[model samples]
Target: MPSSAAHLLSNHYNETRNEYYRQLDTASRNGGDILPFINYAVQGFVDQIRNQIKHIRTEQLRIVWINYVHSRFKTLSSRKDRRRRDLLLHISEFGLLHKNIIGVMALKIYAGKTVTTLKRDIGYLRSEELIEETLTGYFPNLKALTAFLPVQRRVVE
Candidate 1:
């Protein structure tokens, strides 16, 4: 009924993980257990290896999008712990149109950091004030270009 994207992005992944465990539990009852399989065939098991690869590939994409979406929510929310109480609040706050790809790219452009020396001073390059908290995570608050655009004189016919 309402916007489900936020609920989906946050809850869906966790639900999937839960589902996997449930399957494992069922498999345990059916056979012996998955722990034995994991322990014995740690490296050479093709099925396990394939499953891991599949999980990672699917989960990686979800993480990227979900993180960005949550960042947007955090930026907009007026609370300190701005987490979704349920799907309803989430949908009301971040509508479908607001879930934008361009916004995500803008966040990356503003906050992206290089893998440099951890011991090196971070304050030189990073600004704590400019970062915005979204429901998902922290994002660099990128100023809109329109505010800085030069005004153009309109010629009347």
Candidate 2:
């Protein structure tokens, strides 16, 4: 996990633990059966922490994919070239970018460039293995994440 994810998980865990303690104290003072409270708190904490861990994994993957794209496509010197980079980032963030969706995106981001240019950019990304051609459309090749698996394992652990 990255520093931000780790910090957030730590804060959430501490907060949940503190609340569990508070509940336990209240139950003890009131002479109530604390077993139910303990069970509920444990279950809720486990569920919330599991969700947070999944979210952290997703965020980490997105970050790694974006960084890989940036490293591969560093020469964003012209507006046209920059648009290609933007397109790649868009694909990375939101997968299944079909031709029709790309056409709409072209009108917004790749303005002034012809549809041919947009296609060419997509072709270039495919050639570089930065994006993959799926039955639905283009998607960022998350295989790039494998290269950083060691680092990811260390951080997550």
Candidate 3:
């Protein structure tokens, strides 16, 4: 699955290269300028590489976040504790966790658990500095992104 992106990108690059060569051949046969075709292909390559880099960085950030969550909450072994962890993970998917959002998630996931329990779980995550409260609602702390910075720096270098 991971290699799918690389495979698709490789196929795109090959097709682009072939088309560029074909264009160059046609322009040469017609005694026309080839600079535009060269420039266009270069731009496409640059854009594709930039997008791939962005995708890589995003994947790295996700891995770091998941690892951080797993390590920090490793002791949450019991079923109830796991539910709290699940609540944290699920809430992280949303932009914010307000009353309405929490209520909806509670109905879907909490089952026997109460809304207050869900709120308490959120509070616990806040105390752990894993999530932060804002004027709008709660969000996973941006501090977690720090963990990915070193890896990103290495990739950039």
Q: How far is candidate 1 from the true structure (C-alpha RMSD, Å)?
A: 21.9
In order of lDDT, best first, we have: 2, 3, 1
> In TM-score terms, which candidate is top?
3
Flag the better candidate by TM-score, 2 or 3: 3
Steric collisions counted per model: 8, 2, 0
Error of 1 at 67 (Å): 0.9
Q: The CA-based lDDT of model 3 is what?
A: 0.70
Model 1: per-residue Cα lDDT at residue 1: 27
- Candidate 2, 53-153: lDDT as tens digits: 77878888888878777776686667766777888898776776886754544456867667788888889889978888877789888886867665433
TM-score for each candidate, following the candidate numbering: 0.22, 0.65, 0.68
Which order, best to worst by TM-score?
3, 2, 1
Q: Which ten residues in a row have the lowest lDDT in candidate 3?
A: 148-157
Q: After superposition, how far is residue 26 of candidate 3 from its true place, in Å?
A: 11
Model 1 C-alpha lDDT per residue in residues 18-108, reported as the tens digit of each score: 6556655766887776774354333323334455556775565445545554664565564222422112133323433132333433432
- Flag regions of model 2 displaced more than 4 Å: 1-31, 75-80, 105-107, 150-157
